[model samples]
Target: MITALLVLVAFGSSAQSGYDLWLNYRPMEASVRATQFKAMMSHVYFAGSSPQLQAAREELTRAAKGMLKTAIVNTPADQAQLIIGNIDQIAKRGDILKLSKAERPTGDGFIIRSVTNKGRKAVVVTGGTDLGVLYGVFAFLRHVQTNKDLTNLQITEHPKMMHRILDHWDNPNRSVERGYAGFSIWNWHKLPGYTDPRYTDYARANASVGINGSVLNNVNANVIMLTPAYLAKAKALADVFRPYGIKVYLSIKFSSPIELGKLSTADPLDPQVRKWWKDKVDEIYSVIPDFGGFLVKANSEGQPGPQSYGRTHADGANMLGEALAPHHGIVMWRAFVYDNNVPDDRAKQAYSEFKPLDGKFNDNVIVQVKNGAIDFQPREPFHPLFGAMAKTPLMLEVQLTQEYLGFSTHLVYEAPLFKECLDADTYAKGKGATVAKVLEGTYQPGKLTGMAGVANIGTDLNWCGHPFAQANWYSFGRLAWDPGASAEAIADDWLRMTFTNDKRFIDPIKDHMMRSRENTVNYMTPLGLHHIMSADGHYGPGPWTDKMPRADWTAVYYHKADSLGIGFDRTATGSNAVAQYFPEVRDHFADLSTCPDIYLLWFHHLSWNYKMRSGKTLWDELVDHYYKGAAAVQGMQKVWNGMRPYVDATRYNEVKQLMAVQYDEAIRWRNSCVLYFQTFSKKPIGDQYSKPEHDLQYYRSLHYYNVPGLGTN
Candidate 1:
């Protein structure tokens, strides 16, 4: 069947392994105890006729039939036990909600409450707008799917940021950049027709957690995406997404005017350049009126931008912002820029380039900054720009794809990494000013707020390559909705929905997830060691690797390992990148005594014999962290092995095998890092742990072929 319409799959059918995602309409087995939540959804009624509202109805029906073993009949708002609709629909039905000051929704916020109808309990899923109401429907379904109590139900929620987007780095041909999952899901050749049912499933999964936008192409753009042909294909996907309230956006090559329009110059200051963009944007809106906007990655990693014309980043961003503004669209201009020729620290390049242009950006443009000043490392201090850009609205961009964390092969729960950054005190507006508060416009009111994740999805049957990787995608959306949300809380909800609700299963898995990120860090780059992944592939450890076209691109440049000691010194005597932060944050990282052990190596170059806070020498601490990381994976394996009784055979086996691969890779990471770093420290591999199975030369000689994600292109 063509993909344009919804396609339902039978549970346990060979046709689908994970095409259902978390929206599995599979009913509870007879062996499992059922929830006492049937009364909450006894008689459902929806009061709106829009496509979005209709989708809300269909979703509820599908979920109710599966989870409660019955279908819902449409009834009048007041008579039905459950009423679902937007404010306009509720008002049309004579204010069935009678929204109170506390219960009233603001913007895209939703309120799910228990209201009295003739002295009978009735649940109302409603919001101030149709989009919000649709979100409420999904929220209600999630509550049921997780087997939570519905009585005295009151959930008032709104996204903390306006644009919670997933940036898919999928290219035109289907190959993904740094994508550990299989090929890209967007079948470009077959699009604009034969829509896949998977498209709808993707939308449903996104809306279930309140993600409202997506960038459908790679940041390393091709001008062809801006053409009429591809826009038609994009429009097709946008149509499928609209019912779920997700607006489609594109990543445009900054020189599109030159390549697509055959212009001599794509300069922002040039009149011809401005008119070309205006005309192109007009053409796009004509095809898809609600086309979200453009995501630009220019003057970074060799992509052309206004910098090619001797113009600042603001020049490039403001020009595009002007074109999108009339259509109520916005431009997301990336701040991941640096000049290789600039004789400055690579870590400090983005701040030096963008910090000066803060107030100069147009109001409609958001400066998209990576979570770290450097590329997506396993763990790095929060980007200095989090608080530095008061005049500019900054969007926190993180990677959901495990590019550095071991791709899809190894399991790493990313919410802890995200929370660490969000909770960090930027001190931009003095104490208690966190990165989350800054993104919420607490530091600068009336500014645009957004959070973006580099997508990990692909054409794999399970969606994310590893089954557990799905939790990272789930966590990103939940946190994007509310930055202050507990990572553990999100994991609990996801565990119950995606796996089992059994406490025996939930308790151990949640603990495993909470510790997963730190575990990967320990085995890989413990104690604040950042960006030591292998060159080009970034697939394996390569701290000893210094040979690359660009000096800073290699692992050796960041770690600065030498005969004296290891780690880079960002203090006043060194690169002094710490100065970019507010005085308090700078001072906090500058002092070795005051600095946290987790970030010691990131900020200072300490001696191998230097004492750590744990009372272990730097050499011993490093070795211990690497071994601890590998051992933790074994612990995870033990936990999952015990979950077999609670999980199905297919899922149980999938996770079991992945955990085995993770264990092997963890050992490899430990061995390679421990062996290589030992050369500089000249210390013995402590007698307690196993010695390196192979020498450093053995690892360096191990050449891999056809690793995924790094496209042949």
Candidate 2:
């Protein structure tokens, strides 16, 4: 009786850890544990010698141990019920070729099929290569976990995107830019001497979600990273992650010639500077053979670039590209460069700088552009550069960390944000030219085609600070692998794997997860409002702030609120930024009648009494959105409260506490935005809604500085 109680208690505890993520191979209850296949796995057959293949075997062993609660043997005897291998090993067994005829040639393509050869009850996980076999093994395990009968299964899978990567903006000092969870996961001080086990787990988590590469340092790079000492550290991590088919990348400081090489000038046009980078690239490749090349942030936000030396972005990118060309590595030069010095519209800077240089980039260089033109605000129209630079291979860069949307405090699922950009019709080549097509290299994937998520991972036991924030990491990987994947499907799968697979839990939580991003947008920056957060911490609302040095740096510059009304005007009459988009879509945004209502405030400023499509005036609509946002968060709390029985006490209570924080902050946002904007309208907030709890001055005076658990210090 005591043993029974202990067993129940142990089972109860595993349900708590979000560590299982999507590969919770935990055994089902006894009601279904006695099924035929559970007994059929009497022996196993796995054949391969590469590290990737060994990793595949280890994962299968771990899953078998967890689900079957027994040791699985190695040899392929008659009683062997499960077999996993590449096509070469599987075909050695007679007549299995009929089950899967042709072997795929892609490095990471897989085929799983049920076969009857020599009267054996066998399931084969075969792929074109070792990495493919690993993917095949993961796919098979997912099938098992989802309760699919493996008796007669045949499937083949390959990723649509060639390079799915995570760009970690982790500084050498153990800080992550826009990282909300915790300090950097890479313990640089201990590395090269001590290889943290967390590195392998990180690689495993990334590999499971189809992430193929990781840029290990901040794009605002440290020059010391190029030294041999750090190269050895990077090599140590590369060795650990290699087995999982993940390549390590570095963010190259563009001025490394000046910082490290003692060069006179770090000019892209100078032969000395060019030779310095070439030697550096050669040194990096020597340490790590499959080193996924450089991520450069230059000429933006005070970073040194070709512009500093009177050269173009292409000149700087191509110089590095030429150096890496021999090693088959590429350059991901960031297109987030906008003038911090100019008083012009920040939205128009990137477009103006790069559009003229379209088709000028070398084939080995990809321009990494953010989802929005501005820094990752809660909401903004898609970046004008998405379609404008048709000739240059543009890689999509998304912020997985919650930098602008309440950091780690709020429960915001970011699949909607990713989907918003991916699904937007760029109309670059007439209509139907989506950002996904641009990413997949289908529209233009030849030179470079990839999507990079600014990583949110940290040393937290749960990985991301909020347990639910894990969904953003998962969602980014899924979308990177296949840009057309359904956000709802990803959310449902995540809930089942992260928590219980119970319909009651999955249904409501999925609903909540799907609506969470929109809820955040409504509260923080709904209707195209952007960058109105508190100046330093970016934690709370500051819609009334306009005292910054540059006009575009002020909240007033973005929203343009006054006695007249609210929102920036970027039309031809204002900034002429609308002309940046291809005329097919540009015309729609230029004309108020055709522009989508959601973006109306983004591109135009109107009178406070201008009637909206919903029959409310502009002022009334703005207030209504703020009120509705607070109510939505309240609704989310109630929904989460009902899910107590579906998860364990620890995680259940942690999320509940965070949800409370989100609710309180959501109301604070409502109060601050409505009250600040009301000062401009000089209109009553109407007795139906609550008044500001505190005045604008009080809100502005409240400062949250250097908080440990927040982002981008």
Best by TM-score: 1
Model 1 — which ten-residue stretch has the worst lDDT? 1-10
lDDT tens per residue, model 1, 1-713: 11322323334442246556677666765432243345545667777778888888878777777666787777665678888877766656654567656667878888898788766778888887888998888888788767776777888898789999999999998999988889999999999986878889899899989999999999999888988999999999999999998999999998988888889999999999999999999999999999999899999889999999999999999999999999999999999988788888888989999989989998899999999988889999999999999899999999999999998988899999999999999988889999999998887788889999999999877789998899899999999999999999999988888777799999999999899999999999989898888774888788777888888888898888877889899999999999999999999999988999999999999899999888999999999999999999999999999998987777788889999999998988899888888888888999999998899898877655677898522
| C-alpha RMSD of each candidate structure in angstroms | 2.2, 3.5
What lDDT would each prediction earn against the true structure? 0.87, 0.82
Q: Tell me the tens digit of each residue's lDDT in model 2 across 391-500.
A: 88888999988888888879999998899999999998778998888777876745678899998888665678889888999999889988899999888777776677
Off by over 4 Å in 1: 1-11, 14-16, 28-36, 92-95, 101-103
Query: Model 2 misses residue 134 by how many Å?
Result: 1.0
Q: List the residue pairs that clash in candidate 1.
A: 3-195, 3-196, 4-195
Q: Using Cα atoms with residue i matched to residue i, what is each candidate's TM-score against the true structure?
A: 0.97, 0.95
Name the top lDDT candidate.
Answer: 1
